[model samples]
Structures are given as structure tokens and as C-alpha cells.
Target: MHKLGYFYLPSGKQIALEISESTNKYRYSTNKDKVKFPNIESIIKLFDQTPPFDNSRNLSHFEQIREFTIAKGGRKGFTVYIYECEFNKMKEIKGSPFSKYGDGHESLGLKRGSRVIGRYIDTGKKYKDKYVFSSISLINDN
Candidate 1:
């Protein structure tokens, strides 16, 4: 198995993962914690990608907005909005995209207690959480 690197969680914990070159199966372990966590496949599915691997259709879902807070300094001279969201009523995670305009959340019409279909992109760095997405869009069901 080859190491793909670590997956960080919102709780500040990380999972070390290795994948088989031939089988593509993932093996993971947490850093000194024995807490039960999402399986490898589910964790992998949380990431959004481009063509061929763009499974946004399957991954994007209606996330109930719990609350949001505005923060500064994600990008140099830019503002970031940190959103607290829940998925499948099971997991609560923070999602945000660094914005030069400081209106990414407003442009999306996002508000507390609202539900919107959201897509995510991997930032490849630890932000508010391991699943921090670089961007999100409103999914039109029609």
C-alpha cells in the first residue's frame, strides 16, 4: 500500500491513510484516537472533482444551514465566511470558500435554517475542517 497522506477532521484529528496500488482499496487509522468515524469510501465521496471524476451529482445534496460566521484572512486581503452545516442529518461540518468580494455566502442566498444543494472542492489543506471546500453552488433541481 502507498500512503496518500492524511485526512484532517474538523475536530482537529487526522486519519492516516494508505491505498493499495492494484486494488485501490484504502486503509486508515486515526491519530491516537479510537473514536468511530466515517468509512473510507464515504470520506472519499465528500470530495468534489472535475470531469470523469465529477460525481458532484451524487455528492451534492441539500444541506441544512445551521448558522454562519464571517471571518477575515483566509486569502490575503480577502474575507472568508465560515458556514456551519449538517449533512444527511448525521454529520455537522464547516464549509467555506475564500472570497475576494467577501460575498460568496450572500451571493448564494445562504442563510441560517435554509436548505440548499451544495457541491464541494478539495482545498488540499486544512481549513476549518478536513472537508473544507473551495467553492459551492446552488443546485437547480428543475
Candidate 2:
């Protein structure tokens, strides 16, 4: 598994996030096997330079759920489930136009509440009063 990034919990424990082509079942069918993992250094640099939302704290780890939709292109909707590591409160961030229509999170062995690390940018797109990510990657920590 290639180390993609790290998630730092509020308690100061760091979790190493990783990914592997073997875990991706659709790699042979798609170009996923050839796709390079996002640069961890670049992601961290971007995150550090970006300002946090008013009521948002740096995300440690998150849960993801893909809701099926009949909208144009038949793309599924994505909802990020966040539990504030410090506050222990549940919050949600929802959005549409998810690009994965064929093999999705499930194909990567990801479930509704699977622990994941993600990367997002300030695209000025708001989803249900929260910022939406430009892209996210599933962590295959096996």
C-alpha cells in the first residue's frame, strides 16, 4: 500500500492513510490502476494554506455514504458524515454530481461509515451550507 496521507486526531494520535491497486477491483476494467495517488505533501500544503470555515475544525477522519439518484447522468449523490473529534457531535455535508457511476466506493471496499481521509479545496460551491470537496480518495489501509 502506498501512503497517501495522514490524519491527526485531536488527542494527537496520527493515523497513516494508504491505498493500493490490489484493493481496487475495477482497476483492471478502468484506468484506476494507472492513476497516481495524489501527492500527500501537496495536499497538506494546500490544506494549511486554505482557511477553515467559520464553524469548522480541521477534519481528522470522516465517513462517506453514496446515495443513489435518478438525476441527469444517473450519478449518485455523496454525503460526508463527520463526527467532531473534539466535540463528539454529528454533522453532515451533502452534495450532488458525484462522478462515480460505474464502480464506486463499494468497489473499493468502502462502506457507509468507512474510515477515510479526503482532500478538498475552496471551490466556492456550497452544499447544504457546507463546503464541498473537489475530490476524495478512499483509504485502503490493509
Candidate 3:
């Protein structure tokens, strides 16, 4: 379990960010397994950088974020995993359209915990129905 950091929501609940690393280190392949997972020191530097997407509610992580400019400290190969009790028992669903983080990532309909709601992100534009992250500052200093 490559747990990196946790975030405290406005409601007091917590969200955690972890890296999905290849368990079989010996089997590691540069082509198949190569990720730049964020770290504490690097995370702190990103505090000033503009977010991948200012409006996270309308976009999924894959959609809202594309790339992060890191100064140092990151896993060579890993996956970013955001975990939370709120996501417990949560059913997997489809994410938003292509934008930044790209497709393949799942999006869920959530009504619990502290949330930032957004409207339809498509060209048609609909009413509020999406949930998004409030910030990218997931570093748990304490």
C-alpha cells in the first residue's frame, strides 16, 4: 500500500491519495509500468502552480488534470489512487469526456460527504449533476 497523503474535507471526513505500484518489482517494465506519483516536497511546490483544471466539479480527475510539473520526489512507476470512506461501497461508473486527464478513469455519482457540485460539461450543457474535488492539496503534513 503506497499511501501518500490524506485530505480533510469541510465535513471532517478524510480522502487519501495513494500510488498503485507494481508489487512484483522484479517484473517491472519501463513501457508497461512507469508513473510519476506526486510526493510531499513536490506537492508543496504545486501549491502555487495553477491547477490542471480550475473547475474540478465539472470534470473528473482524468478530465480535470493532464500533467503535473514536479520539481522532485515521485515514484518512477505508479498509479494515483484517491481513497476515502465516502467511496466505500461505491459502485463504479463512467467518467466525463476527454479533456485533460483523458478517458479510462471512472466517475461516480455521490451525494454524501462534502461535495463540490457541477453542471453538465458537454456542449449541450445541462443542470447540476457532477461532483468534483475542492483542491489538489492532498499532502498530509501532520
Candidate 1 residue spans exceeding 4 A from truth: 1-5, 9-102, 112-119, 123-142
| Local distance difference test scores for all models | 0.31, 0.31, 0.28
Can you give the TM-score per candidate against the true fold?
0.19, 0.19, 0.18
- C-alpha RMSD between model 3 and the true structure: 18.4
Tens digits of per-residue lDDT, candidate 3, 1-142, equal 1111112211111112223232333245665655545466644554444433445355444433232223111123212222222332222223322122212123344342222221211112112322222222233537
Instruction: Quote the RMSD, in angstroms, for model 1.
Output: 15.7
In model 2, where is the ten-residue run with the lowest total lDDT?
9-18
Clash number for model 2?
0
lDDT (10s digit) by residue, model 1, range 1-142: 0111112222112223222221233223534534454466654543322112223334331211111111223334333333344462222233344353234434445552232222233233333342333343322337
